[model samples]
Target: MKRVLCLTLALLSFIPAVLRAQEPAAPQEGLNTVMQKASYIIGRQFGADIKSNLPNVDVKALLEGINEAIEGKPSQLTEEQIQATRVELQKVMIAEQMKMAEADKKKGLDFLAENAKKPNVKTTKSGLQYIVEKEGTGAMPKETDDVVCHYKGELIDGTVFDSSYERGEPARFPVNGVIQGWQEALQLMKQGAKWKLFIPSELAYGERGNPAIPPNSVLVFDIELLEVLPPAANK
Candidate 1:
């Protein structure tokens, strides 16, 4: 909430510059000057950010507040009142996010329960589940070893968030450098093994999901373990 206010202040600074340039402000007349057009573009960008973050904001109230602040007029709201309002709004937003995260966590647990019923799916004691698509004869990787693999990752809803195959290149990382689910599975998998992995939110990102993934989202990954090699220091 405070950051949004800061952004609002920064964007409004453009208005004074346009006023200094003697740019006319008449929406009915449309953008006729370069300064006006540029300011409109900046406003549109700010509008996009606000829409994505605070969809329920009152546009009229927002504009009025901005105008008051810019015109050096006394605001209907005192600074203390605005700060208190922001604190309350932040709490509401946090509560809403928690509800969404809990819902996602429940969906993931249900998916894992059904997935474990499949004949090929094996559930570990720690709750990791996977299906071995192809067996490998090579040795498995150690925690410190870096493994090269091709993998495609998706959410439970089949939203593909990442894929090494799409980039036409394999990815390499330490066995223990990944999420808990990947770390555990990689240690049990051998070079040349192909597996379909079902990772619950707890073993995946939990409530702090990646930018590409939603909070508490269950993950699905199709991985081909290509090679396992010691870390650079080992060589």
Candidate 2:
């Protein structure tokens, strides 16, 4: 997930401090030593999650590969053999991911079909569905306009993927620069309007979804349009 990757990157950024701490110094004065020890503890916590995702991974072989690479030593496998293995593994991963995506796509389609029948839900020609929660008397945003809004996004399964509300901040971006569903819906909405948007995968992330969202997943969003600003403001 995106959050996991972000946390990992944040933790990895501390490696420099850890390295610097390895310098000879009095025990009490050694921040780097303290950091290195802390990193190992944190790494084990993160490593457990990584290992869960890679259940079939050979831990010993992986450590050996890392150690050999770091020591500038030849690997037990030849370059050609390694390349072949990597290519094979890539194919396997892709195949498995696609199989999961197909299942998700079916579930998304079924959910959308039933959701469209609900009262007040309007389906657009692009297969985007939305329910206007509040009407605004203010002007509508143009395609090139930048807008400020608060939004909560989730998958069809009701798994929260992202939210500006949770962060206690509103997000601002170009109306045309977002996903197709948001683009269409924003253009139709006036400033101060609130809507519950149901976006099919095609109008959302499609087949290759981002780290937080799975492939072909339908996305739901609760959005409140706060302000429509000039496009130049963002630039």
Candidate 3:
């Protein structure tokens, strides 16, 4: 009985290999097809982000190295080749990402610069600047205020991936507990103040973009300060 059980187990394992080998290669080709499609889609998006900044960049090589690393094939090449490739790939990715970030930063600064030339724009002491295109007299928050706010955040290209507003409730956090841009801009607002904020990548998510925002993405926020709790509110 034990011998029969062992044979059965061995055959079960071999059966799969035998079946896989005997099957037509069409299914494997199909899998490769899907993989290539997915890779191309992702690569294109990445290329767009990189291209906005890098005038002469080889996104394909960078992506191929990244893919190889992800696939655990770093040792596929000779050790020397692996080391060299890794170093070059790292430099390219970092440089490209940095370039993209700088471009986004410049875009934000450009917006500010152009707006500064217009009337009614104001600059605050904390380097928080604003051009109130439209003002809603809803209460705004004081500097020390802890507030509940709803925000819809998007890239300059209008790709919105985040919205506390869409979640059907406000995101409750301290006014001082967010990004530098939010910290600086929110303090300029009062309870119930609704503002359109253009945040430079530097002041926003910076070089390392968040999941919703790509590298070097300048963020736009439609923010509403809902409630400013009292100083002793948390206590």
TM values, all candidates:
0.81, 0.70, 0.60
Task: Enumerate residue pairs that collide in model 3.
Answer: 138-192, 139-191, 139-192, 140-190, 140-191, 141-189, 141-190, 141-191
lDDT of 1 by residue, 1-235 (tens): 5556777788778767766886465554577776758778877878888887888989999899768876999989878998999899989999988998899899999999999999999999989999999997887999999999999999988999999999999998888889999999999998999999999888998889988998999899999999998777457
lDDT of each: 0.88, 0.87, 0.68
Query: What is the Cα-based lDDT of residue 120 in candidate 3?
Result: 69
State in Å the error of residue 181, model 1. Answer: 0.6
Q: Model 2: which residue pairs collide?
A: 21-32
Give the winner by lDDT: 1
Worst 10 residues of 1 by lDDT: 22-31
Residue-level lDDT of model 3, residues 2-121, one tens digit each, is 333454365456545554555343545433544444445555655565565445767677667767866987545798988897688679868767886777767767776775575665
Model 3, which residues run further than 4 Å from truth? 1-77, 118-121, 125-127, 131-144, 214-217
Report how far residue 167 has shifted in candidate 3, in Å: 1.5
What's each prediction's clash count?
A: 0, 1, 8
- The regions of model 2 sitting more than 4 angstroms off are 1-50, 57-80, 230-235
Weakest 10 consecutive residues of candidate 3 by summed lDDT: 22-31
Between candidates 2 and 3, the TM-score winner: 2
